[model samples]
Target: MQSTAKAGPSHESVVTNGNGNGGAKSTPPTQRTALILYGSETGNAADLAAELASLTTRLHFRTTCQDLDSVSLRDLLKPTLIIFVVSTTGQGEFPQNARLFWRRLCSSALKAASLRKVRFVSFGLGDSSYPRYNVAHRMLCARMLQLGAGEVFERGEGNEQHPEGHSAGFREWIVGLREKIMQSFPLAEGVTPIADDVFLEPEWKLELATTDGTNGVMEGNVLPLRVANGHKSEPSSAAFSSKLDGTTGVVPNEDILPVKGAFTARLLSNKRLTAPDHFQDVRLLDLQLEEPYDYYPGAVAVVYPKNFPADVQDFIDLMKWQNFADKPLNVISTASKQLSPSPLRHLDLTHTHLTLRWLLENVLDIMSIPRRSFFASLAHFVGTATEDEAYQRERLLELANPELIDELWDYTTRPKRTILEVMMDFTMLKIPFEYVLTVLPMIKGRQFSIASGGAQRLDEGGSSMRVELLVAIADPPSPIIKYRRRYGVCTRYISSLQPGQQITIGLQPGYLDVKAEEMSVPILMIGPGTGVAPMRSMIHQRLAWARSMGLRTAGKRLEGDVLLFGCRSESADYFFKDEWHDLVEREGLTVWTAFSRPQTSTNAGVAGATDGDRTATRKQYVQDKIHEHASRVHEMLVKQNGKVYVCGSSGNMPKSVREAIADVFVECGASMAREQAEAYVDVMERDGRYKQETW
Candidate 1:
């Protein structure tokens, strides 16, 4: 049996017993139905939800996976089992894809009896370093319970920063979830669940077809080019352009473009932002767009970077696929009935002919940390003759077991080992190409806040615009075997680019939700380290507007515009120092800087001093500076109705800043209790007077 209805903003439908392939017949409904819904900003939760749906299907239940926003209250009420996989984003806020659903759920009209028949379980993906870890899923579970939904099991929290990695907690939770399901709803007679096999059944099958001259090549399709000595053909200019346009025909330079997807841009320059002797390596990159693109001050530029050539070659060597590296191949699902829905299903596979090398480099994320299932899958391919293979298979199975999670963490995550390294280490385990494709994670782009102002242009004609980015090259805490230095995939790829080199990119609207062009009141921006990127954009824009209006400070002190910036040392990492001074002089901008490490000249040598330095002047943090100017900040936020913007590390910076602001309300003789002061900040957030962009 199958049923369909418009569920969410994407207009996606919930389906049961229906394969994803068109024209495939639906299976009869099972005794019970389950719904696996997810809200994901980065697709992690969605992937988990899909996996759970497949598992439930094997258990003889009619299961459907859909985004939370797509399903209404009425739809949610029907499911006997509802599994929620959600990720928390931006200071206890729901993912953008789930915001509308969350708002509707929060409506007072939905009483306790609305979801009385529903039985639910929740799995949250979060970073434990944040103050409001797993807040989104926690809120959802609480609200559902209040609406009379029965809990199938305790809510599971998957910590990305966990010592054993998020998969450790997830694997443990799934074991418990399976037990709960079995107890709650026994399988019907004559129905048997699939065994926990080591080898994954092929969801997708590989097929090869000889290119016929009659069919014209599809746009963006990777067609094999004939080359001498059986070499692969270079990517044609048309193919490059088509890849930039993605599935959507609209060019990136158009005024209105999709918030996410691939686009093309040229590297104009890559200049070092910090001194050579500095411990941190920061680069100032300038990318030239094809044409003037309309973007707000706080917008972000997403770069779709490829794997390092060396790493890609390493993977190819390990797979022993040099012979088939350039061979044309097509992928299609083996079963007519799709076990789970996949974005890859939409691709016209008949027209696509991708090479093995291209798939490894452009399609899969080989460098990602492997989940527990990955190890278990590899064990299936291990040869049992050699003691090493036998030991490895046993060890891998143990690692997959949730009870030995710490050992798994030590072996893989703590050392920051990549999947490629793990495969190389297990010399006897040779995984099939099709299995590898099914298991590997998809490559995603890295997003950076655009640092340039909206008024700035690369050239006089404005046909091409220039945008700046500040990137800090990542260096692992300690070097691993075989690798000299560890670099973030995207940052390293960007750093390797030369002037005039073209790169594929995309644009994503800023999540700060503050519009600089619509501002009518004073703004206070707090940014530390590289967090100054978006703040710089906003400051430049405001200064440009002030210049056009001929505005200036009438007195000794500036009013309205304020920026609080923090960094390690004034000489080493003070970004745009001269620009800030110019803005203060020309546009009446107020600026405050907190240097966590200050350089002081001494007889011994020029030494770096911190807050502990007694003889030398003390170093200060931005939070401390805010505490010092409590009254002034209170006046700006409460009395003057000014907006507060924070951009920085997700760890403790955001929480510290909020605490500092709350203290201002209490210390300013307002007679407000601490709880009330905190609530005041919550009100500011809800009113859109306070915004934050943190990673």
Candidate 2:
């Protein structure tokens, strides 16, 4: 989606003496305003920011909520207290929406004390499993501090690894958050914060199309939907007939998305990379673009998957919304009585049209486990006609209570109960049809790293522009529920694709940032499993560059390039094995293989020159292999001024791999003190010499 708005000059610029006016107490609570900005790859951070806005509003502060991309560093110069809610995506890079603002914040044009009066506290939503956990928020906080912005409170981190998930840490932070902000702008005389149970109006409101508004309302307290030269317009059913696909509204074709630019890609092939007997199912997809696309190894392909028809029908039946499922409703901004654009205008809907079933099937996520916020919101919508219904509503409210955290986990997370299942269980909960948009989270497009890129990655045979992806299917059987597997919405859809099937996709600039590097710059690559995808792309392109310069294919060809590949066995999941061997033999690229699942360790067999380890006694991972070859790794990194590119799962793999690299400096070549070695790596990361692309 595009940025909603541009950053204008500050309304009330306040220059402070580094510590005084950032959170100036002159303004009363009612006059005090808070600006909440979020950088969310998924809907998590945005949703959290919205909740925070609601809570802050109840405290008698006028609050404004927006995405980071919608504003700039200049916007922070205002006297208003700002709160940043950011999430790191794709190798610890800023999410797409936040990138522009982040770049502006980091620009060297501004003086060190540029944001001296910008008062803010930041909260990061992240998974600690990755090595660069909460790096985006941490960096933003550090940058703001460096630029002399006053911290209204110490920053907070919400780790998904917590037993109670992100909410656990959030609850703790929010307790301090409320207190901290309230202290900064104390409640006016005899005023107290509104009770938590008190209902607050939603930010967005829904209005049915009346006879006078059938063509779509454009004035007087209603949201205006404009097209072309900004002529006032509003949502109408005809918008659906012209723009949205029939029935599902998520059909895979042109005009499906990207009001600005979107293209179709036909599936050239969808081959399973993993062996049939292997427990994990992985597929290699080859998609040929209808338009000529740029070749970038680390770029991402954004895809939106459709929900299964059966699941959508089940949810409709549970909600008892079949009768009006097809009717369109105009969503107006409750907070902005003035004109505001609908978020989906980018979908080419001249006027927005939302049908209940159409939204459920194409826009709302019903398969993922429901968060506690879902329970809290749904409890307000329940109808307690009978004694059983009253008990169910009470149960829903109880689950929302922070005191019963474990109980909430059991009822939702542990069983992985989805929205549909929750609706089935709490039959008394009947959310009004118009309020569905506010209750349900928005569906976000999933991004998969492009596997194929470079000069040799294209076919000029007048057919298609090619991009590839290595995807692993997620369909494990549910632990508590039988007869159904926990299938991931996007991955499952990807696995069902057939050759020649065209789907809508957008190419996103990958975070790899390797394309501009010189061919002679050495690269130490560490990739296990499908992480090899980007590495393969870079290697081929590097080799192609060397060839273009008429250099020898061996030692002179992108000299010191090395790839450390780890997998279960040489026989299975040794993805692109033959290609690696060929590159080693012909292009002077060093390739190391670590096979973990073999029963016993096997000899090098080849004098430790060509093929890497044959087998390991116990399970050997990429980190283990990094240690064995630490000297060579240190030589490439320290002596040759090389770069390191690591790609893999965001789980413990990235953290373990990073620690192993740190160990290499102390134990192998550099032999510096532990702290110094870590500092060195940190410097490399800051300088962009060390990069990771873990999902």
Candidate 3:
């Protein structure tokens, strides 16, 4: 069932009112109906709700999943089960997609009455390293119970980040919920197969024109192109093929221009920072932007990445689908819903172009592994089926069953294994392609905290900005795949590019939630590793502003600024060592370091050579350092009136630091209430005094 009403009693109804005047509608009389309400960020929760509807429909139960914003309180009370799946984004808040739904679900008025008949189950998806891990899911469960909603199943939480093993806690928990439902609800009688199909067709008006004046290609229309065999790097033509055979496709446009005059920069310098003896290889990069691409010192430059040729080839080897090593194949949304739309939309077909090899290596996530069900499905087709395996056929059931597949690619029955190599063995693996394509989200661009305000220009008429970025080197321990040893996409791509390499990319201005004026407010920056990129820019801007105003104090006295950086060592992996020192010695800046494996006084001169006795100890990490200087950090915030910023891995150090700050607030003044302390934390975040950008 579908409802588009945005508000009022009719908006809350399941059945339309008899009046043709377009007014309130009456829902079916009180009956044994099931409501599948969802709060999703990237639609994961909604997808689950749909799947649940499918399952419920098979049991002959009426089901509906509605956006929380459009749902009425009366509708919620009628649900036999309320399942919620939500993701925690930036600062433990609701995902942007779920914000509106969450706001109404927790409204002050809804908490007043009992929702006694609602038998609900909630599953939350969150990264453990975040400070407010699973906070949204927890909030909904608590609120629902407070409203007297009956709990058929206890709330379940899943962690996306598990340093040691695959994180499928949520998936596992969900299986248990399914079993519980089967046991509780008897079959309603001879049930019909779930509707032929059930997926929302979100409307996209063509009025939102593309840069180039054309109706972007429709699905099923084939566009063939010839391209050279090379990496998905610049200079190589990147193209793919698709057909209009009952599918959707995004027409290829010669130009999808980014913002006008987007910043153009030169590769000032690049150098490897890691010691030759170390297993890992890291680099320090410096770039100089030309013209009006000026920056506000604290901003970061977003580098576009290209795939390595060798890695791309390996991925092609695994897919074994086609020698797309050279020839591009027709790509389509292998997705199920496009069939219904007579004139399929552009997105129904993803912009799937380029050779299968290019798609696997550069476009598709190579690191992801095939779902166990993918293996089970192929079992019947490839003649690889055994009597035991034949007993159970569904891919979903096999995936949940847990009989592991040996050699991940063997399951796919494909010649090569790109998915297993890229997303999984390198470190971790997301679900299979079907799941990723069906359940997960797309890979998004990384946002860096901008670092520098450009120095004054010779011509007073134009302006430009400077940005700093920390190059990230990735080296996954893989004896199986040698290509896994290279650096990451974005950072590695930037590191290899030459001075004159012109590139096309996008820039997302700061959400405007955080902004600072020149020379007016002091900023405290706490970033380790690449997180320091923006801090460097901020420091540069502060200095430029001071220089522009001619304010130079003797003991670094003008504006308040503090920078904390963490790394493996000082000599080898420390980024921008000299640049940071220059900011201090030459430009009067203060920079601090938290070396996790810094060379102790006794371990000096341990470079360029490997001594068997050269053992490094783990010193304090960024979080510990934060705790060590909590009092001073607090004084800087409360007394010095400074802002706090953080960047880096979202899972660990960032959460630790925030928790440490909370601890500091409590210890320094016990009299301050807990909510008051939380308020302070919130204040810092809301004001950009406390800000973060984590992966």
- Give per-model TM-scores: 0.80, 0.84, 0.61
What would you estimate as the lDDT of candidate 1? Answer: 0.67
In angstroms, how far off is 487's CA in candidate 3? 6.5
Off by over 4 Å in 2: 1-30, 77-79, 89-93, 106-118, 127-133, 143-149, 160-165, 189-192, 208-213, 216-262, 335-346, 351-353, 460-463, 554-559, 599-609, 612-618
Tens-place lDDT digits, model 3, residues 1-695: 11211222111122211211100222222233456666654344554555555444443344455546556666665454556666665666675556776676677776445676667777777777655677887887888888887667777776767531222554456567766665555433453232212222211111111223223354433322222242222222224322111211221112221223345555545667677887566565555556544345434455534455545444444444332244333323321222112112212123333334433333344433344333322222221145433343233234334333333334332323334442332221122222223231222234555544445212244443334455666534444445434334455555455444444343434422343352555666787877776666666556766665666565463335667778777766666666665555554455556677767544422222111124445576777766767777777777777777777776767778877777777767558766787789888776556766566
Q: Would you list the clashing residue pairs of candidate 1?
A: 7-70, 8-70
Better of 1 and 2 by TM-score: 2
List candidate 1 segments past 4 Å from native. 1-35, 50-54, 57-80, 99-119, 127-135, 142-151, 159-172, 189-193, 211-260, 343-353, 383-385, 457-459, 479-484, 516-518, 544-558, 601-616
Q: Whole-model Cα lDDT per candidate?
A: 0.67, 0.71, 0.49
Listed per model in order, the count of residue pairs whose N, CA or C atoms clash below 3 Å is: 2, 1, 41
Q: How many backbone clashes does candidate 3 have?
A: 41
Q: Write the per-residue lDDT of candidate 2 for residues 278-354, one digit (tens) a residue.
A: 88888999888878877676878877775665677678778777766655556666543321234454465444444
Question: Which candidate do you rate higher for TM-score, 1 or 3?
Answer: 1
Candidate 3 yields a Cα-based lDDT of: 0.49
lDDT of 2 at 285: 91
